[model samples]
Target chain A: MIGIDLVQSTAETLMRKAAIEIPDDYLAGLKTAAAAEDGDLSSFVLEAMLENYAAAKEDSRAMCGDTGCPRWYVKMGNEARIDGGPIALEAALRRATASATSSVPLRPNRVHPLWRTDHDNNVGIGAPEIEYGFEPGGDWIDLVTVHKGGLFGTDYRMLFPSDGIQGIKRFFLDSLVAFGKRGLACQPAIIGIGLGGSKDACMVLGKRAACLRVVGDRNPDAKIAELEDELKDLGNNIGMGAMGFVGKSMVIDCNIEVGYCHTGGMQMSVHAFCLSSRRAVARIYGDGRVAYRTDPQWFTDYQRRETVEWPQAQTKSG
Target chain B: MATGPNKIRLSTNPTDDAIAALQIGDIVYLDGTIYTAREGVYMRVIEDRVDLPLDLPAVSAANFHCSPAATQHDDGSFVLGAVTATASFRFSKWIGRWLAASGAKLIIGKGGMSPEDYRDHFVPNGAIYLTTVGYGTGALLGRGVKQVRELHWKKELGLAQAMWVIEVENFGPFIVESDVAGNSLFERENAKIAANLEAAYEGTKPAVLKRFGETDDRKDEMI
Candidate 1:
């Protein structure tokens, strides 16, 4: 049996590291926002992102309570074997989930939709979610865990089949509009677009795309990255200024994830992350050893970046 | 005495009392106040037709609700900033009239002020709009809350209906949005965007032709 304590300790440490790294990306992204003329990434947006960060920090809780369906993607190697066989993965994951919940103080956001009750532990049927894959001839298991805070206000998107290839553009633009209508304006956020998958897979990948983004990073796909850059610039130019306050900086980065579709349908889903941009990508080996491949400080810093301040409570019209 | 407005600056940490005492015009130096609040509260005030408990007789000045933090002060007081809630657009729908009727002088929030309805209703009724720094909740809260007041929502409404009135101090060097004359920055920006887009469209030309021909003409190709 894998030592539950070991699994829990490792998961806790990874989450802590990821939390600390959120703010670094935030500051770097902010500079990008300031540089653009009409960028969607605005100071107002940054401020909002920072606000979420501060709340998460001060409260020391999940950055956003929406903490949607928890999901983890794990790649196991052939040599990997737990003392207890198949149940070992489940046990280790459960321990990891427990550690993350208490250590990160994650909001007890998971629940049974029909029952309308809080799981209180952020776990439910197939929750504290994890997906595992095994390699044929490797000695290490690679674990990538993501706890997405789905802001329905920002994450939900739909693309029509008839709109054709242009539908993709329309879907994105419409998502932006919907997000704005939801009052996500002036929120310096990251956009994640998931393409080609079963309906559920598309949604999952879209959110996962956001999780994969580096605080100061760009998408690897040059074309998609360029589009993200353009969108960021255009969004800031929307004049929704910080917190929609009217200074540049709206969205800092946009991430795109492409998934193979089982069916021949053009489907896209998008998710946005506020400045906190909290996500952890860790490699847990077959030995249950974990290492943060990306400097976790980025997530921490993104959470701590600054926002505009008010000088006083009262004011006179000029 | 310190120069300028009696500014109370909080770092990223602040005490509650400091946050509670916040009044319009007092420069609040804040260090904390994590931003929170979904659309629920604003909508409750806007579309639900429920009388807001947090609604005051008149707000000569007010700022809060972008972020809320629980913080401590050097002097051992608990303060919070960014905890105050105010959404200009949603509130302006109905409370704008209430503000005018109540002789409220200023409304401070993230987005700029609104339409003739607000201007005609409030300006004539004695109100102005101010824009506060959006992300500075932590900095403001660090200064300490000057006061915290809990308002009772109409009893007929559910528990979710209640509003909390938290007064903060030294919260801004905020900008003016709508004045007695009814000017608005949001409107100005939106209009400018239209003009700029129109001009850009008019100036647009075939990029390939412009780039190739502008370059030393390809003599061989032309021949």
Candidate 2:
């Protein structure tokens, strides 16, 4: 059985890591983007950002102030069982979040909507939103906790059947244009676009895509992958630059996740993550071996390997 | 409009002439004090107009729009983590008159503030909106602020949301985009930059043509 004590300790450790440390891959992506940034002013800004990221890790404080709302994605093994039930699991998670607030010392992000005071010690009504999945055979409980920030791109859109790819593109470009250069959300942003399925599915998938997918990774589907790359290029060409100071490297990556829908409308959710996207994952096995993960591999097995075939070219007469 | 190491220092609150003399695009290194403000603090200063928990003269001279990452102690003490700069667009509501009246001759921030009332609020009052550039939060925090002074609403508003008053010397090498003459670099330069971007994206339009129109069949919508 997976003990609640181990789960609690591991969760707190993971939360601390997510709060202070950035994953290696994400750092590499920022460095790469900064190195490739053109224009004198933009280059200067990118250098500062790199220096800041380096120092934030070394400093006794967090990298950015927004610490944001807490969220978790839980992938549990069918064979493994929690010592207690969901209540116990939630209690452990709550205790872990409180520890982060005081020890890892995350900024208190939770405030009551009406009273606006520390409630449940940063563990309020349904705080630290958790998404769950079940795997067939492992005896470990897998948890990925994200310390996410930014007020933009929280509530997304539902597209009609007529909206099509054009609608999705418009939604993206407009959102970028409206929100870019504001700096409330960091620049060289990584945007995740989710299509199809229910609203919740799209939002969750989009958020997972933003938090889990590394900056340079691409969807296996050729067309969607092409869209991803195209958006990146288009974003760079927009001239918002770093900190919107007239440069070329505004957005580093654009990720897309898709799901099937009932013969109905398409729900598109767009999640834009600032450069400081902080998240950490941990896998605790029933055998008592705990594996901590910095990289979030959200869509590990869902990659599409099937190639697309084109029909015969139309004749001149046609 | 030239770039140079224009190292200059002025009083916390400068005369209208001094403010107007500072041109746009001049890289400035501040050698004085600046306070912090955002949604919470702005409301206190602009709306509530509370008897600012600070020395009026020093605060009026300059301020930063940052909700710094700070940790509060039990006795209402705190230490700054990072002075992460936020965009000034959100502060547009009180960018004019109030800041001018408060004796703020300079405002430092990222992104930028609106330019609608620049002439009315900034020009006659002698103020400028400075943009922090090239430095990340750590660079700004390490080199800029020397001491974290008083924090208002520490126990009340939580850590990051409270009003932070900090001391600094040669705190920044910020760019002056808004001058006392009411000229805004962002307002002036945006059109030119947008034109250049438009030309570039127009060339790449054909590659992702499906994004604009229904070139492909509906059956292949998912594709």
Candidate 3:
């Protein structure tokens, strides 16, 4: 069984990693954006961000003062068993979050929505939200931690089938221009677009598309992947770059994720994973072996499967 | 760093001539003392009429709209990590009065106040806005802090809202968002970008169902 102590320790490490380190994929993407950036102000902003990442690592401090809202995506294999059950696993995660909040010296950004009460530990009623996904096999649990900036760069809209791709593009530009002004959304960012699904699900999907996936990864569907490319080019061509300056580096990458929805409606949501784009992941096996990596590897073929039954044989063959 | 953007170093309690000479888009690094004060501190001083904790513009003329990633230990010593600014537009209502009351000359934060705000409040008060680079550079800023002099109202306002008095040297890399004459860098950039926005949205169409009170004007800013 996977030990609870191991789970807690690993979680603490993930939190620290998420706060201080810019993942390799995102760092590379930002470097590419920086190289292509021409606007004086925009280029300066990108260069400063590059230096900030290095400083964060060398000093072992958070890359951004507003460390963002820390959240978890726990993926478990069917046969996985913990030292305790799911409840114990959750307690371990919570403990890790609180401990790391103080030890990492992260700003206590979480508070009561109305009362504005601060726990100073980043743990309050429903704070540090824990979400889960289950895979088809293996006796292992994957822990993914994402520290995403909570405000701005996210929007939702309800549209009809008649609205089509044009409507999608319109809203996409609208969201980017609206938040990208004065560097509010912190572009050149990873822009995630969610099409289809219910309003809430659309938001969730878009957020996941932005936070969970690494740069340059595309949707499995060819048409959707093509749309992603088109959107990326369109965003960069808006003549806006870092801090909403005149330039061509607004979007480092564009990601689109879709789900089935009501026949008559096409719900859409847009999310931006900022320059920091902080995330880290680890997998704990039944034998107490743990492996850590940056990519969450969240969108497995199984996770996106449309068939009602697990097409085990076909998936294996493929 | 070498090719573009003229850079300057100024004191937190800068002279009027120093402020006047600055131009929008110039890079800046600050020296001397600064303090963190946001909505909570603003509301207390402006609305609640709370007495000033320390001498303002005397101890520091720089008002930073920030909450550092920090914590206090059992022995009362503090550990401050990253330091970055929050959006400053939200405090527009209290800004004029805060500037007047505190004699603040440097308002530092993220995503500067509106052009109107710069003209109406900042210029008249002999103040300017310095926007943090990267809307951050938190760790770099943290490195600039020589000392955390004091933290005020932690029990009353909590860590995020409490006033943090800090002393620094070479504490920046901020962009001059607004100058003494009230010209805003962001607005200038926005106007230039707006000239090309129509072409970018050429093939796109607005949503079939529009929300009430939504403006289709592409130039309109949400801030």
Model 2, span A245-264: residue lDDT tens: 56777677889888876576
What do the candidate models score in CA lDDT, each in turn? Answer: 0.47, 0.68, 0.91
TM-score of every candidate: 0.58, 0.83, 0.98
Which predicted model would earn the best TM-score? 3
Cα lDDT of model 1 by residue, A1-318, tens digit: 244455556666656544433446655676566555343323333444455555546644444322334456665555665556556666676666655654544434455657534434556777766765544444555555565543432443334455444455545544543344313332556777787777787887676666655654655558867766765555545444454333445566766666566454666787766544556656555566667664322112212223454223211110
Second chain only: TM-score per model?
0.51, 0.79, 0.98
Q: How would you order the candidates by lDDT, starting with the best?
A: 3, 2, 1
lDDT of 3 at A75: 97
Q: What value does the interface RMSD of model 3 take?
A: 1.0
CAPRI tier for the interface of model 2: incorrect
Please tell me what DockQ candidate 2 reaches.
Answer: 0.22
Q: Candidate 3: where is the Cα deviation over 4 Å?
A: A314-318
How much is the lDDT of residue B40 in candidate 2? 74
**Model 1: runs farther than 4 Å from truth?**
A13-20, A23-26, A36-167, A177-186, A215-241, A244-251, A261-264, A286-288, A293-318, B1-184, B196-223
- Per-residue error at A198 for model 2, in Å? 2.8
The digit string of per-residue lDDT tens for model 2 on B22-92 reads 88767677665677767777676677777777776655477777766556667866555555566676777
Ranking by DockQ: 3, 2, 1
